[model samples]
Target: PFTPVEHDTTQEVYTLLHSMSHALVSTASDQCGLATESISEMIMPAIPAIVLYAKSAEHFALGGMATLFETRIHPWVDHTIDYTEQCLLDPPCSRDETGAACHACLHLNTVSCESMNEYLDRRRLVGGYDSTPFWDI
Candidate 1:
C-alpha cells in the first residue's frame, strides 16, 4: 500500500534506501534479534551509494556481530550513518523528532532539507577515519 510518486532514478534510489532501512529495522526488531548474517544482507545494498557516493564512511566498522556502519567518519558520513542508525534504532515510526540525528529524510527532502540533513550539517564534526581502505561488499 505504498503511495504512487514521480518515477525517477533518484526517487528509486531513495525508495530503495527507505525499503532497505525498513527491512533491517523490522528484521532486527522482530524475530532475528540482531545477527551478523542478517544485518550484513540488510546493510550491503545501500552502503556504497548512500555512504560512498555521499562521501560518507568507506568501510562499515563492525563491532562484534552487531554490524554498525561507522557514524563517526566524516560529517556527511556521520550524517548518513546517523540517519540510517536512527531508522534502525527507532522502528516503523522513524520519527521526524527523536533521533541521535535525523538525515534519513534527506532522500525525500534533499532540496529544502527541512528535516535530517540540515540538523546534521549543523552538528559538530566527529574525528578519526579515512576514505582509504574501502570495504567491498
Candidate 2:
C-alpha cells in the first residue's frame, strides 16, 4: 500500500507517461494510415515506456505501422516531436487547469486508453511552469 504522498507522485508519473503515449499514437496516426482510435497504448511505468500497437485485426491488416517503421520511422519521430510543440488549442490548452492535457491535445478514446482518460498532461512533454519538457526542443 502506497502512502498518500507516494500515491500522488506515482499518479503524476503515470499521467506524464500516459499523456506521452497518447501523443505518440496521435502523431503516428498522421504519419501512418492507422486511425487514432485503432491504436492502443500499453504503459510500463517501471521502465517508463509506452508501447503503441493496433487494437484490432482490421487495423493490423492495413500494415500501416509495419510500413511506417520499416521506412518512415525517422520522419514519424520528427513529426511527433514537432506536433507536440503546439496544439490546435494552444495557450488555453497549455494553461488549462488539468496541467495541459485535453481532448484536443492528448486525450484518446476509451478503446485505446487504459486509464479512462485520466492522469494526462501535455506539459510533461512540452514543458510548463517549473517543469522541463521530456523531449529536446
Candidate 3:
C-alpha cells in the first residue's frame, strides 16, 4: 500500500534524479563490490542533488566505497546517465502517464530509499513523452 500525495512538476524532477541515483547504486554495487543494501541515497530536491553513500554494520567502514567515489564516481555517473537515456521498458515507461517505475529498473531495497521507491519515472530522467528531463533545464 502507498500513500497518495499531490504530484507536481517539482516532485517530478526529484523522481527523475532519484531514478538516476538508483541506477548509480546498482552499477556501483556491481562494479565496486559494495552490496546493494550498503549503498544508500539522499536526494535533496531543493538543491537537486543526489548524494550516494555506503554503510557498514562493522566498525571501521570499508574503504572500497571511498576509493570508488574518488576514482570512479565520474565514470559511474556517465554510465548511469547513459543507461537512463533509454530504458528497456520504454514506450509505457516513457509515456509517464502510468507513473512508470518498475522493479526492472527503478526499484531498490526498501531500506536503501527514503521514499520507499515511490514517485520514480526514468522517462523523466531522459525526457520522454511530455516531461523534460531536469538535466536539460
Candidate 4:
C-alpha cells in the first residue's frame, strides 16, 4: 500500500527547486491586464502558467461567480465531499472530455451542476487540458 507522506522544510526546498525546472509547469492564471487578486480555483489550460483569478474591485467576467466561490467571500467552505462530487457529476455531457474538467467552486455562476459541466466542455474546445489543475484554494 502507498504510505502517507508529510511535507517538511527540506522537502519543500526540493519542491521549489523542482518547480524551477523546465519540466515543471504552471496552470491557468488570470493575472492578465493589471489588477492583483487571489485565486481559489480554476481549470488549468494545457499551456503553462495559466491561472484563473477572481474578480478585482475594478472589473469582472462572466466567470466571476466561479472565482468568488473559490475565494469563499465570507466563511470558508464546510468541507464536504458532496459539493466537490456535484461539480464533476454533470449529466448529458459530451464525449470529447479532452480539455479542462469541471472545477467545483462554491459559487460557479451556473444555475446547476449540469451547466457547469457543459461550461467545462466549452473550455476544452477553446483551451486544451493540462495535467496540472489550477487549484487556488
Candidate 5:
C-alpha cells in the first residue's frame, strides 16, 4: 500500500501541517503568555494533523495553554489565522528560492521544532504562487 508519488505527497502534507503547527505555537506565545521555546509540536501526517504541547522542565505545568484551550481557543485560532495571512518578511520571504519559509514567519526554535526547522512553507498556510492554503482547503 505504498507508492513513491504518494510518499512525496505525504511529505508535502506533513510540511504544511508542521508549518501550521508552528504558526499556532507562535500565536499562542503572543496571546497565551507562554514562551515560544516552551511549546513543542507533534505532526501526524497520516492523520493530517498537528499537536502543540507545552514542554517545560522548570515547572510542573504551564497553565497558559490550558487556559487558552479552555476559554480562549476560538480567539486563539482566529489570531493564528490572521497572523499567517501576512509575514513581516514577505515578498522576499514569499519568493525565496529556499521555499516560502523563514525564521521570521513559520519557523520555531530548535527546542520547539523536532524537524530542526526544516520542510516549512508559509505559503502552505496562507496560499501563494499557486499553492492553495491549508486553511482554505
Candidate 6:
C-alpha cells in the first residue's frame, strides 16, 4: 500500500535527477568535445544534488571537465535547463503521465548512472502539466 506509493514518489524524484544528469552530460559533451560516454553522473535524489563528472579513457581526462564545471556551472545549468525543457519527442512525452523522456532525451549509458535508467522523465526536470520543476533556472 504505502510501499508502492513511496516507491513511486522516490522514482519520480530520481527521474528528475536522472533527466537533469543526462542534460548535463549532453551539454558537457557538446561544449567540451568529449563524448557523452566520457561524462558520468552521481545523482543524490534525497539531497537533490547531481554531480556530473568526466570519466575519460585516460586518467582524469586532463581536468577540462573539472574546469568547465568549476568555472561555468552557471551557464552550464542554464543551458541544461533550456535543453531539458524541450525534446524531440515532445507533446506525448511531456503530456503523458510518464513524461516526455525516452532513450533520445533522458536515458544515458549505464556506466555513468547509478540508477539503471529505470525511472526518468525530462518533463520532471523542466515542468509538465502535472508537476513543476525544482529549479528556477
Model number with the top lDDT: 5
- Model 1 CA lDDT for position 111: 26
Tell me each candidate's TM-score: 0.24, 0.84, 0.78, 0.21, 0.87, 0.79
Stretches of candidate 1 exceeding 4 Å from the true structure: 1-7, 30-137
Model 5 regions lying over 4 Å from their true place: 1-6, 57-60
> In model 3, how large is the Cα lDDT of residue 87?
59
Number of the predicted model whose TM-score against the real structure is largest:
5
Clashing pairs in 6: 93-99, 93-100
Candidate 5 structure quality by residue, lDDT tens digits, 17-96? 87888889989977778888888988889997888888974443467777788989889888999988887887899987
After superposition on all C-alphas, the RMSD of every candidate to the true structure, in Å, is 16.3, 3.4, 3.0, 15.0, 3.8, 3.8
Model 1 — TM-score against the truth?
0.24
Q: Candidate 3, which segments miss by more than 4 Å at Cα?
A: 1-9, 57-62, 134-137
Higher-lDDT candidate of 4 and 5:
5
lDDT of 2 by residue, 4-79 (tens): 2246766777877887888888888778878888888888776877888887767463588788878888888788
Give the per-residue Cα lDDT of candidate 1 at 33.
29
Model 1, poorest ten-residue lDDT window?
A: 119-128
Clashes of each: 1, 0, 0, 7, 0, 2
The better-scoring model by lDDT among 2 and 3 is 2
lDDT of 6 at 19: 75
Taking the tens digit of each residue's C-alpha lDDT, what string does model 6 give over 1-137?
11221566667777777777777887886565678887788877688788877775565564778667678778877888788877787777677565576776777778876666656777666766767776764
lDDT of 6 at 92: 72
lDDT of 5: 0.81
Distance (Å) between predicted and true CA of 55, model 5?
A: 0.9
